[model samples]
Target chain A: MTLSPEELKNFLIELIRTAETRLPVDVYEALKQAYEVEDNPIAKQHLGAILRNSELAAKLGKPICQDTGTPVFYAEMGADFPLRSEFYDIAREAVREATKLVPLRPNAVDPFKKKNTGDNTGRFVPWFEVEIVPGSDLKVTFVAKGGGSEAPSTLRMGLPIRGVRNVWETVLQAIVEAGPKPCPPVIVGVGVAALSDQAMALAKRAALLRPIGDRHPDPEIARLEEEMLKAVNELGIGVHGFGGKVTALDLHIEYAHRHPATYAVAVATNCWAMRRATGYITSEGKWEIISKHITG
Target chain B: MTNVYHLRTPLSEKDVRKLRVGDTVYLSGLIFTARDAAHRKILDLINHGEKLPFDPRGLAVYHVGPVVRRKNGEWEVIAAGPTTSARLEPVEHEFIAKTGVRMIIGKGGMGAKTAEACKKYGAVYAVFTGGAAVLAAQAIKRVVDVYWLDELGIPEAVWLFEVEEFGPLTVTIDATGKNLYDEILERAKRKAQEILSRLS
Candidate 1:
């Protein structure tokens, strides 16, 4: 019962479309909370506009943002899955098709050649990061990482002796420098301990994967997230950098064990759109697409 | 005092200079889109002593890269949202003065030079809601024309759009040289210091 390429392509298109047009449940809820709690009139207006934009995009089944962003997929495959060899090509085909059907903005550009692939497909694009799980099914999540938010993400390397405080300061500096450019109230994801690229990727995953207000299981990490959120909101950068009390809707932290002498901190932020969707498929091509906002 | 104004494009000094920080503006009429690549091309054209593809005076230039789809043989805007303006900060002052565009639409703030250019050249910078691409597209009445679609590609092409009430744009940098983003940065820096110090 191997999944056919046509079936996989169709599922991927649906996944991309859902990710583009709708906000996830946690993101939507946090925005509503921010709108409710915002004290500044200007910030309130910006939040209202964001809510309105979300509403209209949902209604029209159109893209929530103009910059549909870079489509990033994280896949978990059962070790026993039969279609592993064909999955990559099928996914690429889906991205090209989705560019036309879902009308995702063609964002891939050749750095040296200055060429636009036009269909949102290019070398190493619709980027995939895969893991093998024990289950006998495939699970994939799509996150449309918009450029404005990604622009302000940063990584700071510190001496291990500087510890968590330095990481905190770096996060604060990143947010302060980012100001209102990444769009607020932004979700801040902090990755500590891992080196460079892995740290950055972990930071992005923390930003994109974790649900708003979902505290980490570890008490220290949870406390840091809470403090980070409070500190960011106090900066008064507000929505659209206009100044407000709800600058950051949520802050998440993920960490990995690192070398004793070096500490690397990565900070990644996501815009309020927070576009993502999840899908599950089996060898027999039984597809289940579940998006929190769409369903709830 | 912040006032909401209905600004029709092909703006004037009087029209733009009077705008202040935090004023809400609804822009109707014609506007053009240009990103970094298109800006480079337009500036190159000017440097080469060639005529611009379109008139820039009194018109608003949006720093955007839109997603457009072909519908019924016509270009339909799927989502047209503002991109970060800081990427164009180096060239913006020159671009604004040379082109004589009265309004610059983008998100995130530009630099002091751009603010100075706004003051010196009778131009203003406004921020459209970032990530509101689909909502912004609703205001675009039609795609009037496009330039450099092939040479520059879709996102980099200069797209001329006929828009009606195309914004909930907040004037962040005004003709008098005041900038909301800069003011916020100062406050944010002070506030950040306070937070960092207390945390330490």
Candidate 2:
């Protein structure tokens, strides 16, 4: 039985609900660790509050944050998927339905016209990114990107001769200068690529996609991640920048083979409330929520 | 040592003067939410010498754009956590002076300008937990009124709320002008340098 468009929309709605109300287990565990390691009273109290807040949101079926965030969907689909053509419309309708059902804040607004869409859907909103893979199933990931965290995002373009050093400095300055704005205990995603937007997109994916402790597959990249995480923690900006032992819950670095002449580094930061989840649908119409959530 | 103070709205200089940076505060009474747009409007009203929509003197201004809905002709608050406070740094000093709100509640501490205003105006800047919307919503008892709903929309509009024990707010900037985050961040910059030197 092939999954109907209605079924796909339902799955997407569930995906948005999960992203809104629940904290992924990995993210929760990382926060718990941050709370445990912090000697600062303010950081500890704030982390404690965040943990309680997460539990409350889950229990009450309420969004974890007021800033419900921009709806971002990343799809990895099989080339032969039957529902590929209607996927975009299905996703958009799902967001509109989820906005009313989940009671999401209407976040989409026209920059020039200064008018809210009343629904979260608007031109190019609920940003969809797709990559065709070599499978017969469809998988979708939803990330709720908050405005406060996005406020501190950075892009630094520099020459490639001092590429590694520049990337390091850029990340450091981004976090240090970010101060408390991005919300501490942040996930720092760093991307280095030939082009600016590509670097930013990669950085956002790294910040929003990977679990907190997940390291890159490449040893060199993994080592860079580890070093950045260590250095970030030393910055003294603990949970909500209260100044404590844990600054960033995790630091992620993703890079593409860059142009020899130009090196572009982008930083995307997510708050402790990293709201994301994945759903997979088989061609046979079977579907399941894949992301583990913080239950207790 | 951490001191916990429970404060109520329509506060005074004495009420705020007792506060110090890092002290925990649980605020009660009315708190009206505002962000960049609302701040600008409030400042504009003050500059124009116009009668405000509501009496703001001795109240608290929350830095938030909450998610709310209406059911059965009553407002229902869903998620209402603090927004970034630093964004209002440019006009906050004048806001405090003109409005006389004793407590400014938000997250991510404000800058020197806000801190100076807090010192000068007998006000305190406190941080409600960032992104703890559901938890924050639980403390808010009722939506008292609303302003600029049509013009600024929900998030940017002035949402007057009646909150009860609405915090685990950390007083980051106090009436006496001491700012906790300023000191904390200053120390952290030294560590950033150390990490960079070690990296080199």
Interface RMSD of each: 1.2, 1.1
**How large is the interface RMSD of candidate 1?**
1.2
Q: How big is the positional error of residue B55 in model 2, measured in Å on the Cα after superposition?
A: 1.2
DockQ of each: 0.80, 0.80
Stretches off by above 4 angstroms in model 2 are none
Candidate 1 local lDDT, residue B183:
80
Q: What does TM-score give for chain A of every model?
A: 0.97, 0.98
What tens digits encode model 1's per-residue C-alpha lDDT throughout B135-178?
78999999999999988888889999999988789999999999
Tell me the chain A TM-score of model 1.
0.97
Q: What is the TM-score of each candidate against the true structure?
A: 0.98, 0.98
On a 0 to 1 TM-score scale, where does candidate 1 land against the true structure?
0.98
